[model samples]
Target: MNYRNLFYALALAITANLGVMAQGHKGPAWLSNAVFYQIYPSSYMDTDGNGIGDLPGITSKLDYIKSIGVNTIWLNPVFESGWFDGGYDIIDFYKIDPRFGTNTDMVNLINEAHKRGIKVCLDLVAGHTSDKCQWFKECASGDRNSRYADYFIWSDSISRKDMEQIRQRNSEPNPQASTRGKWVELDAPRGKYYQKNYYVCQPALNYGYANPNPANPWEQSVNAPGPQAVRRELRNIMAFWFDKGVDGFRVDMAASLVKGDPDKKAVMALWQEMRAWINKNYPECVLVSEWSDPKKSIPAGFNIDFEIHLADKIYNTLFFASDDPWGAKGKECYFDKRGLGSLDYFYKKYADIYTSTHDKGYVAFPTANHDFQRLRTGRRYDLQQLKVAMTFFLTMPGVPFIYYGDEIGMKYLPGLQPKEGSRKRSGTRTPMQWSAGETAGFSTCKPENLYFPVDTENGKISVAAEDNDPRSLLNFVRGLIKLRHSSPALNNDGKWQLVSDHSKPYPMVYTRFVDGETYATALNPSGHSVTASLAHLGKAEKMSLTGKVKYKTGNANDKIELGPVSAAVFKIR
Candidate 1:
């Protein structure tokens, strides 16, 4: 064989597999163009008339999901669970809950999703287990010598006051500080107390604490026998699923492990161990984190992580967050239609992360996740206003997740009765409205039997209705998603830079550039119109949500006038 021919073949193979193979640790190659749709399993659909979304139900919608340009599906916790804390409190790591389907159903779902070029990411609760879990039950005995007695953290001596003292150590910038956090007691007085990650029923798994104090005997070292065993089991759990053809996992509360590690060196080390194992065994699999800290999580072994956690006020400033979360209503969010909001704060936070880590990994921004209010909630109710927001979500840098039903302008109905443990979050997770049928195309069961109530007020907001209207939010989202997938500069690895003055953010502008091609996106989500001189950015066919984007040649360049709550994208230098 000629040397030139062999070299050409090698380069071609590497180019084809660049994202996953050539670029090690960046993420799976498929993720470069992946757009995620997060499905709250019980609320997506009910195929068996059991009033709960199942694996088969998701399998049935693969076509619809693909049509909307979603290439990845992040299914929230489908494993066996006690249903407490909305499936975060896992019962069995190996078995799929009968409520969702069998383990084989999951394998089939993965096979079917892979057929459509859709990757499936299951939610992995790596931190803890429900009190009902056999591991928890066995360890709850407080028997120090039992096989699984060390699987979870246990203490019969430390008091609540001491727990508070432990909480005070290295706890300044923490996000998961809820009422049930820190520590909880055994329900039936089992002579032992255990640490709690979220709810009382969920006991924290012992991955070891970072700083093992001599005073706190319950604190185990990161390399102790118990912690070492837990680490092996985590790998065992992941390998079990990976062997069944699962793509990857969205690790829940990823940063909440290795307690007492203020700097989180130990927690990162634990995941790094997991990542190394995955790199060797399942190189194509990816790991996204709920850590909300891209700076740390990306380097710590996650391929992708959240741009902002709900507790972080930075993201809150862009959406429906108030300056004082407990005291007031939402202030001037950039997406709100009042013309009072600005993107300066959010842009600064986002740009810092992008500049530092864009090449190493990605940061994810979901339009509205399980913990967030929908885009159509409260003062942001107008559909045109939402269109502007959707345009930004689709065009922005990094991987984006569209919550199910948000494409059809789903409403966040507040004050609904809670289910399982979804208190206020219940409103954000109502069933998907497939049509205007009697049950909103969710389930054949009676309305009362649903996981929660489907919005009766959203009678005209079903997918069937929106699919018929080109101007509907659903159709607009579909078009935007198609544009994102088709555009070379808009994929995950593209460079993002603020295209407008940060101080004057009314007409928020940004550019995504890759492979020497550039595109500019401008948005005016305020109640009033604004004009900006975008001379440097030449022009191309405009992809817009409103007709208000008027252009005029001013001297040397084009000046764009964006109308109220309008958005447009143009190809430029």
Candidate 2:
């Protein structure tokens, strides 16, 4: 047989081994095992003098990310979009946003990430396009008799009189007519018409399937009218990026893709189609759905799991205003949102769990990203208290994501409220403060035009400044992440058992097991000492820690004395 024929034969064999014939359970293997880091490209770093972080900027920081041991990167939208939504509202899927970089820049990023064994996953906005997108404009203009006219959801028309009558019937006792209109006019020049709607800039897409005909209203339904057309457009976009070498996609607002469906079969079909198409062309590529709903199921076409229990876990405790472990009595710390639930409750609530991301409200302790406020700035936890949060998150069974600059204890100034530009770009998106340098070594752009301003006073708080400080929070986080990577029992998929629920307020203890190995982790939630018993477990091995020994196992002092909200990990044989 010729070499060409041999190549075809090998490809078929590889596909068969990957379980392509099995529809329900077969999917990519790397997903469950891989650790991911979310990158806010514009805020991560700047290689050019434009003061905006771009593709090269991310390329330059790969070493820093890799140093933390993550193998996957989930970047927020980098596609062409009006700068207002921070890249979520996409204008064009095929092109890169100018502020981020060019198409070639993205290709280069994929290449670089691949070389380091890291996968690149872009934000795929499958739900809605920015009102500025060309397709929306075409639909408004009635140009070329848009095949996409029904692709977006539109409300039926009713005259001003009918609207007024409906409002009168629904009016409150005060007779306030809040929504006194029926058909709202499209703001565009051609359509020059309106529809009663939601999120003026975002129009919903059609998820039904039928062809448009005056006799059939269902024919005008977005999905009913032309499911293939919409699917083809999205498929083409996915293929475009796949050919450019993106490893996968993290679909945006995925649950909204198919609205008003009881079984969720419409969206599930879309995902299944998208998944099937990608697997055919790029077998290794993964599709991660972002389903914000707590009851989210593994959609028909999804290769990896998505947002579920992890959201409430982090927001309700780590970043919530009620969670401050060290808040002054009668008044909570500015951001403590804990005690609404416990860490064990968060872990036990899910049958399956996903651990990190950039979409969180604040730094997801043990990991932080650029989308929210910096961890140091949002919460006032002392270093010791901070370590407990970190140890708990990093040592948990799934992948751990570390935001840029988090390892070295980056801080945003408190009370630096957000300004008119991109939401609060002022504080969290500031440049990586390497040292007390001019402009924190972030930009040559005049300080005023920068996407964000420097966070430190005289730039004193920086990576270089804290690197040499032995007691620095930066070093503490690094030590924890390094330790997590060192132990398979701590980092791998495991069965976690809650061993103690002592009546104490803060210091907590738990054990995790995987592959015949057991790990015991203890955490202190306050600044003072709190002791807990390790009485039940037999024959203890050595404990892992940095400072002088304040507690030990199996001794006359069998109590674990945690130092002022600190934490420690011990491996018992």
Candidate 3:
């Protein structure tokens, strides 16, 4: 062959291989073993004594975060917002909220975090925007021809009379008319009603639905011009942050984008398109969803989907059980020590999700997020209970997210008035108790001026107090994270096999394998000693164990005895 022809052929072959690699990409390469720490920015710290946490405050604590053995940090919404629904009611996607500092401060935070080898992920609220947003303002200006008129869902007309009729129909006790509801009406110029996602201040963005009808003209189809325009705008918002060295986003209300999408096929398609664009342009940027359905979200291009605090069926079985004093009605969690919790629901669901998306994405399990009560809340207050809970959290198959203050056993305060749309959850969002000082070392602001009150109970939990205690929960978590980072068998991609039957009570056992090494993990969170047959460990050599618990290995085919509230990790040869 001629030299020129040979060079062209080689170039073609390389390009084809690159295309193949891109198509086969499962997820971000860095996420497989990453340990994430989630920070509620407004409550994490306060460096300038403004009574609130900001970017500079977070930047100043990079060392502390890195010391915890977390390599990735997920910051809740920092964008400019009206603070109606925390920071989720974003007014402008590009501007950082003045309460949290300027754009320059954000840049510094990303730079400082990167210096310590920590990746930063921002919270992206894609499903809605504040009613005060410029786009909404323009759309509500009484002109249907406005440039952003279709950016949000708007009814053509719903007069007071129409609303009264709707209310009358809703007031009727007939079960057939149960779905009837009311939409908020806008004043004069707008002359229409708009759909809201949560609070009245937050309006739902129009992403188009799977089906549209004459009765609901506002529900545009997915292929409509308005939906396409919104998609472009979403891309522009993503591109703006990606240029600033942000690693990725934890999308809020990710699965609820498409209105009236019962099966979620249309919303999934939207995410799939966005993921394709992200993979082609910014391949390293990860997309983590708030959606709990990993089977749908992973295939739709999310790198991870959290099973956060929601209903009883999913995560409640592990943490928020029926006996929880927090007033949530649900079955007992396996970690509750009540012996009423079952592993059947959790194991079956996890196994199904793992089988579907183990190679493509992960199902992140957090210690406790801002939306739920902390692990140390309610009746599960003992340090040993937390230790056993941490064992399961850190050893899970997916990436582990540690909510700020959870390591030190922070308690969820009760009976605090609502703030920024946090009702009962407001207690969980209290300022971090850094020390036992008068203000808990969070800030020097006056007691009344503080964003939220610190836990002032006689025996308040604090990082400083925990630091001095070698066997503290904070230290235990640090050790677990270090072990996870060092051992291939405990990382995200390790093979997970259930070693104990789910029907067993008290002790739960599982094994992780990687690179020809097997790591066996056992947890007994109850108050009584439990014995379990570990014939599976007969052929293997025992390695090491951590925690304050006691355990004894019996004969090859005999049962292994674990003391009350104990956990152990053993490497088998």
Candidate 4:
């Protein structure tokens, strides 16, 4: 064959190989061993003298994030929104929040992240928009002719009185912004009308669901809901940004999109349609549903659903609920007292089990999120306890998500609360304390100008001080993430079995096996030291605080002693 023909043949072979890699059989090449770090822009760092975390702040920290072996970045929404809403109540779908950075800054972030072979997934809040969003503003203006009227779910009166009946019967809060019931109160009559069924500021979208009909007017008419018109508008919003080159999206409140119908086919269809659109254009795009319910399938058309509940089950059970004085009460059984879960269970249930998602929240074990409390301030983060928690979350399966300054153990201060109250609720959301420095490096602005104050004691603790301290949690996280990346069994699908048969209080142990290879991991959750057997292994390479340890011909009687909150992984041969 001629040289050109030979070259073409080689190109075809390479394409085929890459296609196989993308099939996710051996797992997607991007994710097989990827570790993701979640950056909350508001608290990550302050550049430009603003206390709020910004793109430049993030850009400055890229090297630090990468140093720990993280290969992916899942940013919490940086989109334009009212400041206090945690970026989830987006005002504009396409614009980055000014407080965070400019669109150019985001593009720069994507560029830098890509240079290191890291994928970037931004959070998408599709369920509702800030009342300030243009769509909501137009719908509120009472202009029936407005193109955006149907973009959100709004009704002058009950289209489905039956649902209203149920709402009253169950004492359930109205799902709509104007509705009067459990949580929302209708705005007082303006002239003659008091609109019911709406959030004061977050108006819900109709999502094309009509009362009992289960079909909206736009979707019911022939030639309506076609890919070209209304749906096109929504698709355009997504495309506008994906074209800017994001790897994927983590769709917010995923289940709420389809909660109106009993069958849920409408919501499923919408997701599938969006997935198809993405496939046709952005083929590498990963769509993650924040639905949390694993039972909710993606119709074989969409790629992934967030495994939130799976992690919830594990995190709540393994350490948080079991260790805290709160024990497990009501929903507390599913979440820690601080509303996060234990580390061990999260690894077992979802780590490798989930094929695609912006690293399950469990792996990262973010103590503070926009919606929840920071662990440091939540009555959870004792210095030793913090060390132990970090040890478990960092080494377990999936990408370790770093929530801003969590590495340095920055925490929320007492008496400080977010839009929602509770120290645990707002702990991690406080400003980053750069040093014992003034205002903790959050903002040069007067403390009153800042959205949240720096925790006087634990707030925005700096990497500067922690970076040099080998014993600091930040250093510990760096070590664990590096260690996890080095392990093929822990990174991928290793057969995992719980070692629950042990006779110990609060210690956790489990073993993972693949082919003849096995990794047995044990955790001592209790305050006291304890010993456990490595009886499951025939032969194993064990890991301890000191160094690589090993065991051979293990039997039912084999065991290892563990320090309080300490963990070990033994590789079986």
Any idea what lDDT model 2 has?
0.59
Per candidate, the number of residue pairs that clash is 0, 24, 0, 33
Clashing pairs in 1: none
Per-residue C-alpha lDDT of model 2 across residues 252-282, encoded as one tens digit per residue: 7675566545566555555655665666677
- Cα deviation of 539, candidate 1, in Å: 2.4
Full-model lDDT for every candidate: 0.80, 0.59, 0.80, 0.56
Candidate 4: misplaced stretches above 4 Å? 1-28, 141-145, 159-198, 210-230, 297-314, 318-368, 377-379, 419-424, 446-448, 456-461, 502-505, 544-553
Candidate number that wins on lDDT, 2 or 3: 3
Off by over 4 Å in 1: 1-25, 159-178, 187-191, 321-330, 456-458, 553-557
| RMSD values, in order shown | 7.6, 8.1, 6.6, 8.6
Clashing pairs in 3: none
TM-scores for all predictions: 0.91, 0.78, 0.90, 0.77
Q: Which stretches of candidate 2 lie over 4 Å from their true place?
A: 1-27, 143-145, 156-184, 187-199, 209-225, 262-265, 293-314, 323-366, 369-371, 378-381, 412-421, 424-426, 457-460, 466-474, 502-505, 538-559
Ranking by TM-score: 1, 3, 2, 4
After aligning candidate 4 to the native by TM-score, how far in Å is the CA of 317 from where it should be? 3.3
